[model samples]
Target: MLHILGLTANFSLTLQHKDQDILNVMSLVESTKRELQKLRDDGWDSLMAKVASFCKKHNVEMLIMEENFVDLRNPRKRTNISNMHHYKVNCFCTVLDFQIQEFKDRFTEVTTDLLICMAALSPIDSFHGFDKDKPVRLAKLYPDDFSYGELLSLEQQLDIYIDNIRRDERFKSVENLGDFSCLMVKTQKHLAHPLVYKFLKLVLILPVATASVERCFSAIKLVKTAARNRIGDQFLSDCMVCFIEKELFDSISNEKVIKKFQMMNERRVVL
Candidate 1:
């Protein structure tokens, strides 16, 4: 179990990479799914051998695979299953299957499609990730933002946009979506390709820095408690911002806060 779990743990760490582009992240996810499936099909024998070696080295008793299984929780209880069934099917196979299903469940067809579409907008590799169809599909996902006529316009713009961006020297060195968006605005490309820029804005809204968003939501739960259910919107917003950005807020001196507060109102007793 540890051996199987250790493999998935490494995959988990790989997914946590801060600098990985969305395209690479999706590829890693797909590769992990295949790897886990392959491991399930052919890893049992190798896993068993490793377990046996560890048992022998530690002077641990080893059970025969063919022997009738005994339940450790209830020794008096009789079971018809073999030790191999209990260890392999009940433990190893179960764990692997659950992880495989989890990967499948997490990256469903819609989510995968969305990521692929989003990847098309990635500026890494000199706009090599650009796909005309995927970005159209991405725009289609947001029907409210893109009308039927706008979709057709977007396709035409995409043709010109890719050609323009690839040849343009300004965007040649741009890497990642954040830098791409900033550079696009810097060069006023957003004005030239309004629809594509809108799509880029939508993509930028997605939580690329996932840890910060998660921390913000967790901070909200703590700040907006039952006692503070009636907290005003502006006050809640300020409190939540301070709570989430503790380090930044911590650097703010109390004297500075008092001075700022004093400036906000004409206090008769001025400090």
Candidate 2:
């Protein structure tokens, strides 16, 4: 169990990209299956012998034995060290088989394709490693948002955009889609790659998990406690926005806030 857990912890650390994460997890599943099979074949006997030896050496062999011993005279009722090893191996194999099946079922072909498409926005390798077809497939998946013309133009736009980004020293260190988008916005480069910017917008809004939404609900529950149960919908929304994006909210100047509030309605006292 400790060995399995240690492997899991190591794999968890490499879960940076969605597509890569899926591949890593599948690889881990395969590796674990192979390990378990090997254990069942030969490792179990070796491990059991070593464990038995250790227990004997420490004079604690009785700790592993059953409280009531079965009669060795009756072959059907007797349980020996070999039987114990077999039982352990069978149990381990069963658990590993179930885990491998679960991993395969969870990461289907469609899921893999979607993740690979999403990972196309990675800014490494001068954006030359970008999977052009995957993003096209991604755009096709959302016809309502991306028109046929826009989808067709994405490839051309990506070619120009990637070339321009690679040539510009400022964009060399851009690590991910979010950073690339921010740089484009800051430099007003969206005009140069309109289609690419549109694609970036679509990618930015894609929800990776429901945990963030759930966290918002949890925050709402905490914020709208008994003492503040009667908060209006607009006020509650504002509070939630402030709570969720507290860093952005904190950056606003008091004067700017006061000026904005004064502009909204007439006030008796003006700052």
Candidate 3:
């Protein structure tokens, strides 16, 4: 899913039957797609690259990409999926095949700029996606105080929050709320394709970065219980860096650590 300029584009698959056991297929086809000029001088390197460029054109400044985002559990899907086009965001469902019409109907009238998803708790296994996680959950932590009661009623609390996001202002939209609610109810509208993984796998490279940090912070809140709420700022910062990404810390040579340790160790380990 992607959001830009009060528009939300969603993709999904499901199964359905038509006429005497015959089948009707529908999917997201990127027909009549538009390109936003001058966002970047570089053209796309591949289909996945195009998706990233397309996302950028949609005016999404930041993209969170995951490695191996797609999960192609079915082997035959290698040739089942096809190219898709869009001038704007949308949602659609298909069973046993791709359906473009369905995608159009879901996203045509309404425009949504922001996507709120509950942060994923586990490592991303593939391009598998769940729209239910609220993306705006992290934003709530930014000293943007809302009463506990108000937070529970966020969707009802939404005051057409699209414009606020366009202006880069604080807009009260909960993360993954739509994914969990509107999108979830519509899940069975489409059919899963074998090539679903390829599409998503290709897409992962396009996003600017992965939404890993959002999940990390959410985890932090869970671990740093009320008893640890008052922990020192520096300690927490260091812990997050090491816990979430020790590789970055590892990039520093042991020699550097040793030198620092010689001065500060004093029987205590330090970075």
lDDT for residue 87 in candidate 2, whole number 0-100: 48
Candidate 2, residues 214-266, lDDT tens digits: the string is 56888998789899979999999998998977779889999999899999999
> What TM-score does structure 2 among the candidates reach?
0.60
User: lDDT of each structure?
Assistant: 0.85, 0.70, 0.34
Off by more than 4 A, model 3: 1-210, 221-230, 265-271
Question: What does candidate 3's lDDT look like per residue over 1-271, in tens digits?
Answer: 2222112133112111111100111112222112112111122234357777877899865333322222256644443223231112111112101233444453342111111122221112221232312323522442344445544544332222222222332212323222223322344311222122222232233222224534576668755779888888898877677777766887988898788878874765543
Over 1-271, each residue of candidate 1 has an lDDT whose tens digit, in order, gives 6666666776667555555566677787788888888889999998888889999999999998999999999988989999999988998889889989998998888888888888888788887767899989888988899999999999999999999989999888887888988988999999999988998999888645465566677788899999999999999999988887778888999999999999998999976
Whichever of 1 and 3 has more TM-score, that candidate is 1
Error of 1 at 143 (Å): 4.9
Error of 1 at 63 (Å): 1.3
Candidate 3 lDDT at 170 equals 23
Comparing 1 with 2 on lDDT, the higher-scoring candidate is 1
Give the number of the best model, judged by lDDT: 1
Q: Which residue window of length 10 is worst by lDDT in model 1? A: 206-215
